[model samples]
Target chain A: MKVNELVQKLELEVLCEGESFFSDIDGCFAGDLLSLAMSNVRAGNVWITVQTNMNILGIASLTEASCTIVANGMNIPDAVIEKAKDENICLLRSEKGMYELCLSVGELI
Target chain B: MNSFKVQYTIDGEDFSVAGEASRKLKKVLQSLGVDPQIIRKATVAMYEGEINMVIHADGGVIDAEITPEKIHLFLRDKGPGIPDIALAMTEGFSTASDNVRELGFGAGMGLPNMEKYTDYMNIITEIGVGTTIEMIVNTSLS
Candidate 1:
């Protein structure tokens, strides 16, 4: 699935350039724990996390994650959005909780 | 075997800048044409270590040595050290305060996850002297 598809399916607000999600996504892993996500998620997997901290962006960049979906209607911090834009990483904000986002997107990818 | 080394001072002031060293190393490893899996493992493991140092120890020093067979990471911090290595290694046990947990870490999985993905790990510390962690990820599994 492409990141754009995830954006559409979840009805997420694209805080940054929505076109970047056109990149291919290989899998999906949803976790609030950054360490677990880093160890478990593949490079092109879309990471679904509830974290709004700046460190999350660094983790996403290091793992070369395809995109990040901040679940549970969390306010996407300006710093995080800025980092994502600079790194060309797709950042999406969803009002849906982690479980629902996973269930909805899991079936697709 | 050819050898390479890089040392970085993790800045204690900026939490957002914690993973700088690991990020740079990942790029270098990729440019050197290191195996993808090896690069991922090393980068993930080291990145976790770097974050741990910043969050728990108020930053520290990271020494990395790249060779034909493996990548070695030495992370040493001057902050208060762990009292019990065993308790700290448990998946859900954390010494991090509630404030740190709010930052999305302090989940008590740092050491365990570090050990899980690396080939070998050793943690040395004293009550007040600080902690020194050594982690090695083999490029080729034996």
Candidate 2:
């Protein structure tokens, strides 16, 4: 499924405007640890995490993940949003917790 | 085999730019038409090394050599070196402070994950001097 579809289905807030919203997502990986996420997440997967820092953007780009959904309505940093825009990474925010977000993403993909 | 080399200086104090080297290397590998799987492995391994340099080494130098057969990464850091290679290699063993942990890292999975993704890895370290890590990811599986 595409990132825009997931956003519509999950009712996630688009944090940054990017081309990846049309990118296809394979699955979902939920984790806060950067290394673990990088090591485990499959390319084209949607990363569900509570991490709001800029490193998440770096990881997203490195892993080539389709998008990042910050769970639990956390306030993503402005710098992170800007970087997301610059990198063309789809950044989204969700009111649901990690588990719910993962479930929704899993069902979609 | 044709070879290309690139070097990056990691700033230990800057968490924001920790994975820049790995990201750039990924692009280079992509442009060179390396296999995506091999590129992913190299990028992940190097990224973990880059993060380790920032979190533990207070900065370091990364030298990457890309060839037809493999991608080689040499990371050298001037920080408090690991006292026990075995212990440090163990998963879930971390010495990072609380502040570092707050950034969602320091789970002690960095080195282990790097080893997992790469075909070969080696670490040379001294107590107070520093640590140097060499990792290689083969482009083609044997």
Q: Each prediction's Cα RMSD?
A: 1.9, 1.1
Q: What local lDDT score does residue B35 receive in model 2, on the 0 to 100 scale? A: 84
TM-score of each: 0.93, 0.97
lDDT by residue for model 1 (A74-108), tens: 98778878877886767888888999988888888
Which consecutive 10 residues in model 2 chain B have the weakest lDDT in total? Answer: B12-21
Off by over 4 Å in 2: none
What is the TM-score (0 to 1) of candidate 1? 0.93
lDDT of 2 by residue, B59-127 (tens): 999999998888999999989999999999999999999988999999999899999999999999998
Worst 10 residues of 1 chain B by lDDT: B95-104
* CAPRI grade of model 1: medium
- CAPRI class assigned to model 2: high
lDDT of 2 at B68: 89
Candidate 1 wrong stretches, greater than 4 Å? A18-20
Q: How does chain A of every candidate compare to the true chain A by TM-score?
A: 0.90, 0.94
